[model samples]
Structures are given as structure tokens and as C-alpha cells.
Target: MNWTLEVVVVPVSDVDRAKEFYAGRLGFAVDHDTDLGGAGRIVQLTPPGSGCSIVLGRGVVPEMPPGSLKGLQLVVADLEKARAELVERGAEVSEIQVVGQNPRPVPHPLDNVGFVFFRDPDGNEWAVQQISARG
Candidate 1:
């Protein structure tokens, strides 16, 4: 049987703040944002060209704990363009540092596939990677 992963619940300390970051800054589409009938609220966002969507809200979920992880990789088609846009959107993007098991500055082995890292308002480390397709 073929199975597919669907959702990833990112633990967020503040729902509204997260919504703004994921939606306004990163340009993720808010797929679902609503109040949970006085129980809690939910807000979901999907990055452009992303297969999985991130679900984050307060009290919408209980099991996922808030923490920081730096392993999430979101791929883009153009690294430089993505980095520029993220900066324009007010995201605190870090300078393009070396990546992979061994790392170095840009124009390195991964320059063709550019990448930059940043954090959400909650201090969750996230990366934006771009892979160039040579013509």
C-alpha cells in the first residue's frame, strides 16, 4: 500500500503571532483559520510549492510541545530570489552560510543550490533552499 504524510503540527506559543509570521512574512497561504467553538483556535498555512502544510494554533492541539528544531528544509526553485523576497517581507534571514555535512560560504558546492536560514517569531529555525535547473 502507498501511504503519504499529510500534516505537521508546529508547536507555537502564540497563535495570532504565528499566523502573522507564517502568512504575512513567509507568504504562506492561510488554509484554515478559525475559532474552535470556545475551546480554542486553529490556523493552518501552506508555503508556496510545498507539499505539506503546517498546522499551528493555541489549544487546537495538545500533544505537540513547543520547541526549536533546525532540520526542517523547505525547497525553493530560486535561492537568491527566495532570500530576497523573505527579506523584503521583514523576515530576519541569516546570511547564506555553508551547508550540508560539511559547509562553506556561497560559490561553494551548494551555491548552485542556494540556501538561507531564518526563524519564526517563536524562534523556530527554518531554512529556505533553492535548487537551480540549468538550461
Candidate 2:
């Protein structure tokens, strides 16, 4: 059986704020924003070139706390470029650093070791890693 991951549910405190951050700052495409009346709101966004999308809803998963989601990673060809773009879009991102090495002013001397980090409006941490190539 072939199982393809479709969506990940991101928990956020405010729906509109989270939507704006994802769609506006991060430049994610808004797939849908639907209201189910008593069922609450469902908003889905798709990252560029990603088969898996992300969803956050008012009544979806109440147990998960907003800003608690961590270690979400996005792979990029260039960590510097990705971090620069996100910073230009008004997102505060960390400088490129080695993932599994000691902190330094400028790490990632090795290829495929570059990484940057940032967070959503709800404080959901995201890591952007630089890979020399991807298949």
C-alpha cells in the first residue's frame, strides 16, 4: 500500500492571525477556509512545492496547545536565501547554524549542515535546512 501524507494539523490560538501569518508572511497558498457552524472553522494552507499541506481549526484538536508544535522542518536549497526571504517578509529568523554542532557565529561549514529557524504568529517553531541537493 502506498500511503502519502496529505495534511498536518497546526494548532493555533487565533484562527485569523494564524491564517494571515501563514498566507501573508510565509507566502503559503490558502487552499480553503470553511466554516462548519457548530463545528468551527477550518483553514488549510499549502507550502510551495509541498505535497503535504497544513490545517488548523477551531474545533479540530482541542487538546493540542497553540505554539506548542515544535521541530517542524522545511528543506531548502539555500538556507541563507530562505532565511533572508522570510526576514524580508517580516518574520524573525535565526541565523544559519549547524544542526548537531556547538553554536557559533557562523557554522555549517559543511554542506547539508546549514539550518535556520523561525516561528509562526502562534509560536510554532519551524526549522529551515539547507541541502546541497534533493531527489
Candidate 3:
């Protein structure tokens, strides 16, 4: 049996605002936005070139507070390019920082140590990483 991870539920205070941040600012593809009337509303979006999708909805994760989600990492082939794109789209991303097993300020041995970070409107943090060794 192949166990494939498909969707991740992102808790958001405002569904529409989250939708705008993901879809409009981040350029994620809006797969679906549906209202189940009594059930709730669901908004599914997929990042470009990604297999997994993220879902934002009302009552999706009632126990967890919005902005509690953190350390969601996005792998990119080119870190600088991706960070620039995010900035152009109006995201307040962090400057490129060096990351390694030790997580130091200086450059890592492999160029694989670079990372940039940003957060959604609800403060759900995300990290964009470049690991040439993985490719």
C-alpha cells in the first residue's frame, strides 16, 4: 500500500484573509472553495510544483488556535530567486539566513545552509530552504 500525504489543514483566524495570502500573494493555485452550509467552508490551495496541498477552513481545527502552526518548510531549487519572488508579491520575508545541523550565523560547508522565512496573516510561520545536495 502506498501511503501518500495529500493535504495539510492550516488553522486561520479569517478564512478569506488566509485565502488571499496563500492564493494571491503566494501565487498558490486555488483548487477549490466550497461551502457545505451547515458543515462549514473549505478552501484548498496547492503551491506551484508541489504534490501536497493546504486546506483552510472554518471549524477545521477547532482545538488549535490560529497562528499556532509553525516550521512549515518549503524546498526550493533556488533560494534567492524564490525569496525575491515572495518579496515582489508583498510578503515580508526574512533575509537569507544560514542553517545547518548547528544552525549558525556563518555559512555552512555545503551551500545547503540557506533559508528564508515568512509568516501568513495569522502568523503561521513558513521556511523556504535550498538544499542542492537533495537534488
Better of 1 and 3 by TM-score: 3
RMSD of 3: 3.5
Among the numbered candidates, top TM-score falls to 3
- Please provide, for model 2 over 19-98, each residue's C-alpha lDDT reduced to its tens digit, 9 standing for 90 to 100: 99999999999999999899799999998888889998898556598999898888877677788899999999998887
User: Where is model 2 poorest over a 10-residue stretch in terms of lDDT?
Assistant: 102-111
RMSD of each: 3.9, 4.1, 3.5
lDDT of 1 by residue, 14-126 (tens): 88888898898889999989898878887878888677888887765765546554566787666777888999999999887655553434433555455799888777788
Looking at model 2, the pairs that clash are: none
State in Å the error of residue 18, model 1.
Answer: 0.8
In model 2, where do residues sit more than 4 Å from their true spots? 101-110
> RMSD of candidate 2 to the true fold?
4.1
Candidate 3 TM-score, C-alpha based: 0.87
The CA lDDT of each predicted structure is 0.76, 0.84, 0.87
Candidate 3 per-residue lDDT, tens place, 1-135, comes to: 989878888889999999999999999999999988878899999999999999999854455689999989888878888999999999999999986464444343435677999999999999998864542
